[model samples]
Structures are given as C-alpha cells and as structure tokens.
Target: MSAVLEKATFSKEAYKEAAGRLFHNEREQGYKPVGLHLYRLPTGPILYARVRMHKPAAEGVYEKLIRPFFHDGIEWKRGEPKQDNGKLLYGLADVQNLPQALVIVGEGEQKADELTKIGAGRLAGVTSGSASSASHADWSPLAGRHVLLWPDFDEPGSKYVDAIAAKLQVLGCALQRVDVAALDLPHKGDVMDWAERFRAAHDRTPTADDVLALPMTKAVPLDPPIGDPAEIDVWPAPQLLSAMTAPLDYPIESLPPRLRAAVEEVHRFVQAPLALVASTAVAALSLAIQAHVDVKRAERLTGPVGLFMLTIADSGERKSTCDTFFTRAIRDYEAEQAVDGKFVIDNYQADLAAWEANYNGVKEKIKSTAKAGKQSTTDLREELRDLEHDKPVQPKVPRLVYADVTPEALAFSLYKQWPSGGVVSAEAGIVFGSHGMGADSVMRNLATLNQLWDGNSLTIDRRTSDSYTVRGARLTVALQVQAATLRSFFDRSGALARGTGFLARFLIAWPQSTQGYRLFKDAPDDWPHLDAFNQRIADILRLPIPTDEGGNLVPVMLPLSPEAKDAWTKFHDEVEVSLRTGGELCDVRDVASKSADNAARLAALFHMFSGDTGPIAVDALENASSIAAWHLSESKRFFSELAVPEDVVHAGRLDAWLIEHCSATGAPSVSRRDAQRLGPVRKREPLAEALQVLEDLGRLRVEQMGKQITVNPALLEGVAL
Candidate 1:
C-alpha cells in the first residue's frame, strides 16, 4: 500500500493523515506549514504541485517539494513529469478571467493567494513561482493591464519586484510600485504581516479597498529633464556627442544682392529653414552661369563655377516649396529656349535624314561595284568616306534642368545633346537609391561626378554602344534629402562615397527643424524681389556660353583681384592649419581642404551674378570665405557625431532619460530596475554598459549597493520638471 501511494495519488484519508503528520512535525520544529499549492493551466488542468514547508528539510535541505504530473491521454498521473520548465505565473488561471482588473504582483505563492482572497473578485493576483523566477516566466497575459508591485520589506523581495516590473514593462503594462517604506512594517515584513496586524486591530480581515489605499507613484516615461541653473557650475557634467554643437546659420549676406533677396523672401513665404532656401537659390544661380565662366583658383588650378549642395531636413519641412520658389526662373528660361529653338531642331532633323539617305545610297553603290567584279571601285569608296565626313550633326537642345535621371543618361545628355545641365530635386531618394548607384556602377558614377565638379573631362568608353568623350561640360547638383535616407545611403556605400571624394565636394546644411514655429501668413501682393531675381537669372542664361566647333563648353576664366587673392591665400592657410593632426578639422580634412576652392568659386559666382565685370573683388571673397567657413564647421559637427560609438550613443540617451526621470519625480537618484524598465536602455548587459559609460563620463554616479544611479547635480542645474 505504501509503494502504491508513492507511485500514484494517495487516497483522501491517506493524504490527510500524511499532511497532518508533516504539519505536526513542522510545528514541533518551530517552523510553519504554508500548505500545498497547485499549478494549473488557464483551462483548469493541474500540471504540477508544490508543498510549501517554509522551513528547510533536514534530509535534502530543500524548502519545498515539487510533484509534477503527466496526462496519458486520459487522466493526470503522479510520479511522471510532462513539463520540465514551468513558465506560467502562479495564479495565472485565476487572473486570466479578470483581464480588466488591476493585477497585484507579490513575491510568493502564499502572498499571492492571500491577496486574491482579500481582493475577492475585484483584483487579480499573480507571482512568478518565486523571487528568482520572474525573468523566465511568460508575462504576456498581463500586457496592457495596470499592475501594482507590493514587494516584501527586504532586499531580495525588492529585487524580485524589480525583475517582474522590467518584464511587465516590456509587455506594455502600466505599472506602479507600492511604497513599502511608508508602511512602517518590520524588516522582511510583507503584505501578510500587515494583514495580520490589521486583523488584530480591527477584529476582521482587510478587503481589496484597504489594499488599494496604499501609496503609489506613476511610472516615468523616457524624456529629458529640466533643472535649475545654479547647480551646473559646481558639478558640471560632460557634454554628449548628440548635443555637441548647433550648425551655424547659412551666410545669406554672402550671396549676390538679387539672390540674397530671393532666398530671404522665399524663406519668409515658405517658413522653411533659411539654409535650405539659400542653398537652392545658390544652386539655381550656379546652373545659370556655370557654362559661361570658370573660376581660376591658382595658376594651374581651375574648376567649374557650379556648386553641389546637400540639404538635410525632416519630411514636411517644405523642401519642395523652397525648391520651386528658387528654380522658377531656371524652369521658365528652359521653356522659353525650348520654344525658340524648335525650328532649329526641326531643320537639323531634316538635314540629318537627307544625310543618312545619301550615305546609305553611297554605301550600296560601293557594295554593288565590288559584287560586279569591278577593280576600279576606289571612286565609290571615296564617295562613302566623303559622306561620312560631311554627316549632319544633331543640334544641341535647350533642356538644362533634370530631376530624375541616371548618371549614364546625364552624361550622355551633356556629351551629345547639351553641354551644361543641372539636377535639382527635393527628393534625393530617386538619385541616391537609383540603379545608377548600385554596387556595379557607384564607383564609375562617383568618379564622373567628381570629374564634373573639378571641371575635368569625362571619357566614356563603351564597346557595345556608341562611345563619346565629354569635355568642357558643366553640371550642378542640388539635392535635399531626409536624414534617415542619407544615413542609409552612407551605410550602403560604406566608405566608398567619402573615399572617392564624392561627398567631400558638396556643401552640406543640416539646420534645426522649423516645424512647429511656422505660423501661416497671407501671401504678399507681389514679389518684386523674386521678380528681380528671376530677371537676373534669365539675363545670365541669355549670355552666350563660349563653346568650341563641336558645341563643347569652353568657359572663360574669371581671375581674382590682388586684394581678393591675398584674402583667399590667408583663408586657405588658416584652413590648412586646421587639417593637421589633433586639429579641430582633422577628422573632416577632406572637406576643409576644399574650403578655399569653394570660396573662390562662390566669389566668382557672386561677382558675375551681381553684374560685376573683370576680376572678383575683395568684398565678394570675404563674404564667400565666411560662407565656406560656416559649411566647413557644419561638416565637422555632422561627421564627428557620426563617429561616436554605438555604446556611447545609447549611454547618452539613457543619461538624458535618467536626468529627466529624476527631475520630474524630484528624486535625486533612479533605481537600476527603473532605468531598465522605464529608460531608453532596456537590456540588462547593455544597460549595465551604458550606466558604466555615463559614470565614466561623470554624468552619473552609480551606487551598486542600492542598485540606483545618482545623477550629477550639475546636469540638473537650470532644468525644471
């Protein structure tokens, strides 16, 4: 009978007798018996059982006895285990029915059962098997539910609550912690102890209403802090890379008068960032005049007058509106030229058709003479050679602006159809994400663009297609892209884009967003400044581009005055000094090295666009220097931040969130548990590493004993809740 009882469920009488004997033994040993608890599925099947002795067994030194049961297609049988790891939370079967009720998480099975009985049907109670098992349990059932953690008045109990809170937070549960310090309970006391005291005082058990009356605080969200200014001077925290430096404003005053006015007017009308507007305007001016003139930076160094500008902003920043306002004149000029040159194009086509027929006729005669066994076919062959030499050339089109085009097509147009063109667009995805930038063509395309910027010739050698050499052609690129798209492009290109000097040639602007501050205003009666700007653009476009007999642009050189040259040399030396090792511009040496060239080009553009004749003046060079310096600074800020390690970036985010939480709660420190649950860094090891980084940076002081981080008081100085 004893062997049968060991292998199967005991009879009720036998079970009662065994439990009574165990209870008596525990009582005699001055230990308590917390009774037996059953682990069940939500559908009401008993999967396992635990006998809580509360005292260690003398023989095995175990605190509890676990008996797992298995079902063999019929009924549950003892002594045969089905599941090894029990992940379901204690009382999950009971809490699963009350989905809308607030869940009260406790430390042990006894406490969970007590809370459930006290709350009746109003509240749900659950535990994660034990204090250490919280991380392994499936907490999905509590997702989207409000949870309150009532930890015991001990260190282990507090850790248990923290573990549960972190898991629950990931499930999106609204959480709060009961103020255990305010209860005035003894050390290691818990809800059960308080209930006993309550029963002793009131002569009755406390209800769910009594438990709900405990003090609680709302969980803090991840955000930065506001603080007082006075403390910052004493304990200054280290600055983070994310907030290192703000971009300098675009130097609009450096632009020519008409162009500056147009930029300012468009900025006012569209309420976009001034840098964005100015970049587009400058690009438009470059497009109009690039084919007519080049800038001679030195005796042996000459480059195109065109500019490549990249503007980065979030979507809905009115990028398109700004582009349209600035490029209106360029579009109008193209349309007018297209209309006026229609007859020229028609005549060229007619001549080309007649030339092709004549050439084909000559080739046929030569073939017939050879087939007729005539040895004197030299005359017909000479006629064919003469026809090839006199073949009608295709007329150059007036299409000067393109939006979506591959690098091959753009090169073809510049080589065969037009000698000058610009790619102006607010959406850079079409250009950067296009097939022309694919793995096979990115290097070739980047080289081509680099050559165009340098005013060097491009030689296209194709075996299966018509080959051509593009010489003295000018190209301008003005692209506005979002930050994410550009970052993605950088990631895909690895180091090739920067290594090939493709990005180094561009003047970049990453201005602060002007999103929420843009209030609406009525349009002006008429834009006189814009009209003047457009008129200037049209006038520049009408100027004849110096070209060779093959229609290749041979832009005239624009030299700088003596005073302007002196000023440019000084600026160039200054930038050169900053390119040394340990210099502020060392990381961005590629961009800084080109600053002087860009300044010279900008000065030339300003000189020509302002209708100034002869050499570029000193004043224009000074203004251009200022603008170039600003863009170089922008490059430093952008690339330096990108160079920050990922761990440090995460640390910066966690630091901000910690400061914010401390400020909002008026708490001087935050628990490691709260940081993991409510802060930006959630994973355990990553959070630890981030906390270590913050500590190393002097932004935070972590107290391992209490598992909390004390924010540097200086960081909270001048900040408010």
Candidate 2:
C-alpha cells in the first residue's frame, strides 16, 4: 500500500546460493531478487529476498514479503503493510485469472509453483503468513470454488489445516484436505515432499488426477447439522485454568536484620506461618505508628505508612504463637496504659464534680441577687463565668490496638483515641464471618476499611444515636484465616471487594502448610533478637506522638532519600508495566494496579521499623520492593484460583476423582448412568457438564457406542492424578 515497495537489491547468483535449490527453481519461474537485512548485524549485506504478490480482488495491490535463508537462522520478515495480511493471498492474481480451475492451496511459494507446473489449475500459495497466522488469511477468493488444501504433515500443520478449514466452511467453499498421514511422509513433511517421493519412485511428477485420487478428508463445520441435537456431542471449549499451586514463599529476608533474625528463630518452631504472622504484625505496628509516619512520594502524593495484611493457613500452624511473639510489646503497653489510665480517670471525675458544684453555687447566687432587685449583680455573674471557664476536661487514654470489633466500633475508637487503631487477630472469621460482613453491611464494612487504608476519614451515620465521624484516622489490620474460610470470603465478597478496591489495599499471603516439619528445639543462651524486636516496637510506641495545635494526632511525614526515591521510582514504574493488557496482572488488574502504592507504604514502614527517623534509605526501599514483589506474585496466584469459572472448577474436581477411581489397567471405562449412580458427582446436569468439559480438555473422552468415559492415557503420564 506504500507509494513504492522499498527493497535492497541483491545479486541473482547470491540469492540462488543463499535460498537453496527449492527457491532457486521458484526464482526461475517468477520470484524476484529483493533483499532484507538480518537481525543484530544491521550494517551487513542483504540476507534475503522479498516475494511480491498481487491481491486477487484488485490490481496494483501488491504485498511485500521477505523469505530469509535458513543458513543464517533468520526468520522471514515483512514490510509495513504485512502485520495482518488477511486480505491478500499468495498467487492470488493467478487464481483469480483461472475461473472454474481446481485450485490446489499449499504453504510456500515454491510448492505452489511446483503444483502449478504439474497441471494443477491456478495453484495458489496461502499467504496466511504462518501456521499460527492461518486464520487471518483471505479465504473469500476461493468462495464457491472447489478447493483442495495440502497442509504440511506436522502438529502446526494440523492447526494450519483446522484454521483454513474453519474459514473455508464459513465462506461456503467445496473443500477437502489431503490426508498426509495416510501417505508415508517424513515428520514435518510437506506436499512437495510427497510429490518428490512419488517422483523418485516413478521417475515422473504426479499429475492432478493422480494427486486427487489420493485419500482426502472432508472439512467438518463448527456448527452441528440441523437435525436431532442429541446426536451431536455438546462440548464446551476448555478455558485455561491457572496451575493449582501454593502461593510464593513469604519474603522473610526482606525484614530488617533484628526482625528477620527473630522471624528465623520463630520459624524454627512454627515454620513459614511464623513469617506470615510476623509480617502482618509488622504491618499492624506500622498502623499504630501511621499517624506518626508517612512516605512523601512527591509534592502532591504523600501517603500513610499503614498496611492491611491477611495470612491464610490451616489451624494448628502455630499462627497464634507467631502473633503472640511479635505482639507482646503492644499488649504489655496496653496493659501498662490501662493501669495508668484508671487513676487519671478517677482524678478527672472527682475534679469534674467539684467544678460543677462551684459553678452551681455561683449561678444560684447570681439568680438570688437578681431576684432581690439588689444593686450591681455583675460581680456575682463574673464569678459564675469564672466557674464555667474552670470546668475540668476529660483525660484521653492512649490505647493502640483493637481485636474482634465491628467496623462501626472501630471507627468510634479511632475518633475517641489518637485517631489511629489496629485490628490484629489470628482468626480471620472475626473479619469475614462477622455480623458486620453480612449482605446489608458488607459494603459499608469494606468501604470503611478501604477509607481507613487510604488514611482518609470515615463518617459513620446511623439511625441510632451512636453516629460519629473519624477524621485523619489511620488503621492497620491483620488476620489469619484457613483456606476454606478464605474461599468463603471470596465467594461472599470477592466481587464487591474488587469493585470497591478493598482486596487491592491489603497485602495477602497464602503460605504452604508446614505442619509435620516442626520439632522441639531449645533456644540459644542469648536470644537477643526477640528481645530486640520487641524493644524496637516499644521504642516506636514511646516516640512522642505527633499532634496538631488542637491536640489531634497528625501524620509525621517521612520523605525518601534521593537514592531511595530513585530506586522506588524505578520499582514503581516496573510494577506499572504489569497492569497493562496481556501482562501477568491482566486477569487480576484490580489488585495488581495498586501494587506500587502498597510498595511505597511498605518502604516507609521498613525505614521507620529500622530505627531511621530521617529520610527512608535505599536499602529499606529495596527490601520493601522485595516484599511487595512477593505479595504481587502471591496475589496473582491467589486471584487466578479465585477467577476459575465455577464449571471449570467442577471439571477439575471431577478430573481428580476420575484419576483416583480409575482401575490399574487402562481398559476400564465408566458408564454415565453408573457414574450418576455411584460417582462423586450427584447431579446429572453438572456431571454431564463436567464430563463434557473434561472431554474437551482431552483429559477424557466419552462415546455413545459404549456410553462410557475413557480417561486419556496422557492424563496418567508421570502423574498420579
């Protein structure tokens, strides 16, 4: 379609030498010597030639093509208009010129010319590009014409045949494919190979009549014939299910040294679950310090360092032990505060009573003096004003953590306390199966959590008198649920969670169970890591909490160092790439899209936890990026499992059952009737549906002749299930 086709001219002999005998013969017929450059050696001499061909439908419409030499291992290249060459066919002008000719369609320009010389009417090369590109070719030129297709004998050739056949059937052409397998040919052999073998045996090229006489198969249309639908097999196309596997390993090394050492010690006792719970506890600790720390990504983009984390593992994984070990300092601090808070609360109460008594006495005196019509009641009124001005203020207790509370109550605590709170628990059902997570309140709870994660205010308006607003609140939450419970959460809230961006805001981990591996081990004489870990947490708790002029808690911004900012920017940009179409996060883009923001928050948290009150360092951001990378991988795996269609999941379950129940010998077949009677599947419709899916997936095949299902032998190859 360009004004002029651009090509590097090469020597005729050079073209013949590079392209070999097949192309040499084709060149003699009509192939021209136009060349292209090879990859990597851009300045080198031309490596191949472009074969110009005209469109059958129009004149002066030629497609640019490049056929490279195999010696150089260079793939065929195309010019600008060649990405989707659907409208153009090779040798199209020749085929269009021949009316009522029995067109022999094959792959390559050389083969088409070979067939053309053998008296095959209007020989046409399929410019559909490649085996994978077959479906994109223009098959309309052969519409209503009798066409014979000779696909190369290979797996890709079979796909090539299927693609062309599907298009031909739609175009309503008279079609048949040469059964290359029936004829003895080499692996990945072609139509020319068959002809050459015949020539070698008979001392002459095979004619059109002889080639037509060979066994051929008719094309099968995708749609069933208009008759009894029961006669046709109803198989749904198989969707590619994500590989069933555990989430990526938790990033224990990403933790700061003291924390990492402490996690390693705890992991010796509880294994990977310890790392998961510890990571979550760290996130909770970040939330407690959220009001006192923030990451300045840019002038317009400063964010809280809080994190919401969820860990999923089966019970008896010592999830509680891991939580208790990391959270001991927080609990001890809360206890200490409770002890100190009681006396302060009592003193304030007693002072409030005395102040009220004094104010009442002053007010009574002012009223009596006014009623008696006495001179100058201004002195008594000024005393009442003084009493009112001296009214006692209630003391605020510094409480840091919350457990098993509804979202409404959580918001109230945030408002009444330091505008910072955390929900820390080993049981996830408290969050997922709570009354607040019911149908009516699910969105409200999820929305509230999402706001808190963003460091935004939550306004809880209710018909009851307990309505309140929590402004500038920071919330950190961590929960560990069983796999079954997690699945239930997905079932109940997955769509809503994704729609409201609730799931995206949380860092999630689903670690492999390490139940049997744990053994009794004595601690080292100086296990200072655990002490240092708790001590660091206590130190963070004791940092003078930043507050506004009105005594309201405010976030203390923690800007990144120049080195950390540069590293974080690069990491953030890399994460942004995955959110694009066809990337790893394409399916779970809802969560994947938020990965970088989560990384930024994590980097700041890591810096603060490392005892750095200054700017965030490069090492801290690097470690946080490592942790974020793990979470992103786990999120992709987790969501892929969650995204598996209901029917596909049923098919997978049935697949496992079939693999389990099959007889030792490969001869046994299960009857559909008997399967319904004795199989793991109870419902006929769903069982039939699942079986149809498994058949489509090549896991098994069903035949009406036997009314039985035979599992594919390949399904048992090197696999127990």
Candidate 3:
C-alpha cells in the first residue's frame, strides 16, 4: 500500500527519470525489468515507448493502442524485445549538484556513471536508454572540467578516446591523456571495472595520473565521429565522350536526280521525327505551292519504297513519298527508317462489326432457308448487293449444300481471337480482312472484313481526317537517336519482317504486301496536340470503311440454363406476383427457386453491358450491344473477381446471366420461350450452395416475406446491357 502511494506521487513528465534509477541495475536487488515494447500511431506516425513490458502488459494497454495500427498499414511482424544483458544500467542524480571541468569522458551511460566509484565528487554521466550515445542535462554544473579519455586497449576503445577528446577540447576542456594498457581493470572490462578497482584500492579521489595508470578498460565515445569509410569509398559516375571519328559509318549511296531534292529536304529534318519532319516539309511546301487544300497535290505523288513503307502509313503521300525517297537514293536512308509491315498491323486494328454481322446473319439465313426448302443464285446476288449497301445480306443456299455459309462463319470466328488484328504489309495498306478462314474457329469468332474497300470509299461518321500526326521530338540529337533505334530493331531481326499470325493465310492481300511496321509513332508533344493533328489528317485522307450499322448486336442474348429457364416459366405465369404488368416499379417482396441467382445474373449482365474499364472493355461489349450499363457491370465483375477469381464457375455463366435477365426484364424486343422445350431440367445443388455464399456476401436478402434479390446498380458502369 505504501509502494502504491509512492508510485502515485510521481509527476507525469518526470516518470522517466524517477523510474530509471529505481528500476535500472537494481535487478541485482530484485524486480529486474525484463522487456520493452513500442506502439505506433497511424494519423501522426507517432511512436510511444513502453518500459518493463511483459506479455500481459504488452498485450493489454500497449497492444490495444497499437494493434489497430496494423490494419492501417503497420506491420505486426516486428514482435518481441531483446534481452539487455546486465552490461546496460542507468542512474539519476540532480544535474545542478555537479561541478565543471572535473572528470572522465565516456560514450555509454553505464560506463560514464562508473566515474562515481573512482571517488570523484563532481562526476556526471549521460542519462539515456541502453546502447545510446550523446545526451544533455538542463542544468549541469560540471560544464568546464578537464576530461580524461580513458578508453580500453582495443580498436573501438582507442577510437572512443579519440572522438571524446576531440569534442572536450572544442569545449575548452583540456584532454587529459591515459595509456590504454595500464588502466588496471579486467583484460577487456570497461570503465565500470576501473571505477570498482579504484574504489577498492583508494579511499579518496583519484588524480588524472592515478586513473590513467589503472589498466586497460573499454568504453563508448562521447563525441560524433569523423569521415565514414563508406561515404569516402563511394565512386562517381563515368563521363560520356564525343570525339571526331575516322569516317562516317553510314552508306553514301548515289541519289537519283528526281528524288535527290526531296531526299535532301527530308534529310535536313530527319534529325527530328520522320512524321514531324514530313509534316513541316509538307506545310512549308504547301505554302510554296499556295493552292493546296487536299492531299492530292501534284508534288505529293510518289511510289512504294518497299512493302514496309505502306505498313507504316495509313493514307496520302507518306507511303508513296517514303517509297520513292528510299528506292530512288541508296542514301535515301529507308534502312534508317526500318519500318516493318508487321509492326504496323499489330498497332492499327480494324472494327469488324459489319463483317461479323453480315457473316452471322447470312450463315443463319442460309441454313434456315435451306431447311425450309431452297435458295437461288438470284438470292445470292441480291445478298451481295445488300452487303455493299450496308443492308442485311442473306446467304445463298446451294442446291447441293450440306451446310450454309460454314466457310464464311469460319472466317468470322477467326477474327475475334486475333491477338493483334490486321495485316503486315505496306504495298496494299497491310491487308487485315478475310477471303477465307478455317472451319474449326466458327463458334469462337464474331467478325471479319470481307475485302479491302476502295480507298476513296473510306468513311467515318464524323468529318474526315482520322489520321493523327505525331510531331517529332524537339531535341535534334535525341530524335536521331530514336530514329536509329528502328534500324537497330530491323538489324536484330536479320533484316526481314516477321510473321503475321494465323489469319494471314485467310487474307489473300497479306501475301502480296510487305508487313511489319508501326503505322503511328509517338508524338513529340502532348496527347491533345496529337489528337488535333489526327483530326486534321483524318479530314484530308478518308479511307473506305465497311461496317454493319442497322443490325445492332444482341446485347442480352443469354444462354438457356436449366434453372433460369424454369424460373422464367414460373415468373411468366405469375409475373404480377413480383412486378406490376408493364410498370417500371416493382414490389419484389416474394420470389422462389434461384430468383436471387437470377438477380446475381442481372447485376453481372448489366455490368457487362455497362461501358466500363476492365479486360472485357477491350471487347467493346457495351458499345456493340448499344447498352452501356451492362458493360459497366461486367467490368465490375471482372475486378471483383480479381480478389476471388474462382467465384464464377465458368465463362458460360456470363451468357446464362444475360438470358435470365432479359426474361425477367420482360423486354418487348426479346424473343419468347423456346418452341422445343426440354422441360423441367435438373436443379443445380451446388448452385443452391452458391446462393448461400452470395447471400453471405450481402448480394441476396432472405428475410421478411421471402428471398429478395437486389441489384446494386451503382456497381455497373458503361452502356446499358
């Protein structure tokens, strides 16, 4: 009870000092402090130190304050305190009582404290925690004494003496010398041993010489050190040199007269990006001509330098000028450009929606017509006319046909899986369409281009000039260095373009054209400027585009799942039970047998149709469906799946989800139930279990009247599904 009262008598701020002398080194007397712990705060990145920590205290007050930090990015792996052997000890004395210019200088608090045993009346020590150096007291009276640096015989002891003396000398205290080997202590014992020995041997205060002659004793240093070896050993970076060479390594080839002037003009700006240089020359030349509004200027006419030249260009004189420039002069430096047809094809892909629609619609029509009885050549011709005119085109059913438009369907399927869509050639603008496709890919593919439409027929919905120009970098040398990178790339490829993927064989145009090049280069400026240039170029050179516009994608074409089919049958019979007929709002209090499952499907289906950022966004699933909402939802699903990839049983569930939703939404445009019923399919037991899982996720509500499925629409993004 008295100890408790005494403990409570301490001031809050003075707890550290009072606790130190009583708790420290008193371990030999009992109640030896064993452990310590630190707590970290998140908001301020604050650290709180706790002394005398045991498992219970560490886990109680300390743990409660710091444990929550772990969830806020703090690490819990930093556990347990080290045992500080008796080598460490502490002391607390009124600093105002000490005298100046009086005693020994040492590094550690423990060693400095041993000065008291040597019979010094005005001894002072650095009061700090274990293994720490350098501290100060607010009112130390021992500020001006001659300090004797009595370090041990070892290297560290010698270093400590040197450091301590240096600081004491600066403080106007004379450095008293002490020989390391004669300090009369244990072989490797520190200042504490010397103090103990001196106390036992002498009855009064010891002089500098007496202390100096004592025996070898190791101790910590009182001052900061000199130049660190690590810092001194750091090396500087090597310098790059520019020297005059013996001769130019580039080939000096003869130039044809017609290409000579143009080549030289381009050469002047070649130090910049080719696109920027070309555009600058064009703009300057256009001013010189003063009457040009279109890309068909007389001065712009040129020829193919190689198949790679076309690969790098979309329209206008880039191809022709580059070709003529390269072939007309060996010095033309086309080798320097190193444009490959394949690179261009990889970068610039075509939209194949029109081709895919035509293929799919025709294939299905042909099959349906043949089954119903017949198809004529007139029908085929009519279909061809409609295709050219952006109208629906039905395939002709051959009298001897076993399949309808199977080959065309194969081509359509081949295109969807194309990793990098388009041809690898310059001569014919890098063919990217199809004339044939393998039979194996029909079910997997969605679209293909039928032919290379006439260049004059190219069109975009907006005003022309879809081409974006990438201005060259302003740094002349850097631009040249970047240009040289292309040559190195080509040289590494053994001076030949690479392969186009498996689709090349299907496209007849790919064989005749050179392939492997990037059609667009990086802009010297920002994206906005590049976008502006693209708009300008697109206006100047519009290429023919073939697409299907009217026959929009069926966004909600869901697969017929057994459970979903059954639910739809019941929901249709009792539609009024959950929703009012033809009303937008619903009182969905009751539903049964996988209705919550249907709700999950709705959410996913809507996410798919919503236009959102995700891997599936590349598919433009929402845009094609003209339903951005579902696409957005699919994107959400894609990301949520990132944390739990195995959540979806299979990809086919995406299709099944869509089917269930359209049935529930009761959209007028959607088709009704199947005529050929496979009635009452088996209920999925695992799926029932899956419902519990989703319910746990708060994705389903099973209270009140019955099970209620709620779709959190906010999670869905992009176009409606």
Which candidate leads the pack in lDDT? 1
Better of 2 and 3 by lDDT: 2
RMSD vs true structure, all candidates: 24.5, 14.6, 31.9
Candidate 3 lDDT over 624-703, as tens digits, reads: 22221212222222222322322232212322332244334533112112201111111344344443443443223233
- Candidate 3 matches the true fold with a TM-score of 0.21
Sort order, TM-score high to low: 1, 2, 3
Candidate 2: deviation at residue 178, Å? 32
Candidate 3: stretches off by over 4 Å: 1-103, 107-110, 113-122, 126-143, 159-171, 174-180, 186-188, 192-385, 388-721
Worst 10 residues of 1 by lDDT: 225-234
As for model 2, its CA RMSD to the true structure in angstroms is 14.6
The lDDT for every candidate, in the order shown, is 0.75, 0.67, 0.29
The predicted structure with the larger lDDT, 1 or 2, is 1
Q: How many clashing residue pairs appear in each of the predictions shown?
A: 9, 0, 73
lDDT of 1 by residue, 1-721 (tens): 1232234443334433444443453455555555666665665554445445545658656444332223323222332233223255678878778766678999877888898899888777888655545554567878888898899998867767766666676688888888888888999899889899999989999998988898876643323311123421223223333333434556676777778888888888888888888888888888988999998877888788889888876677788887777778888888888898899989998999999999888888878878889577888888888988998777776788888998888988998878899988788888988888887789998999998888788899899987888899899999988655777787778898889989899988877666645888999999988889888888888888899886778999999889998999999999898788866578899888888998998898889889999888999999999888988877776776566665775576677577657877877688888777776566788788888887776567878784978886545532332
User: Which 10-residue window of candidate 2 scores lowest in summed lDDT?
Assistant: 71-80
Better by TM-score, candidate 3 or 2: 2
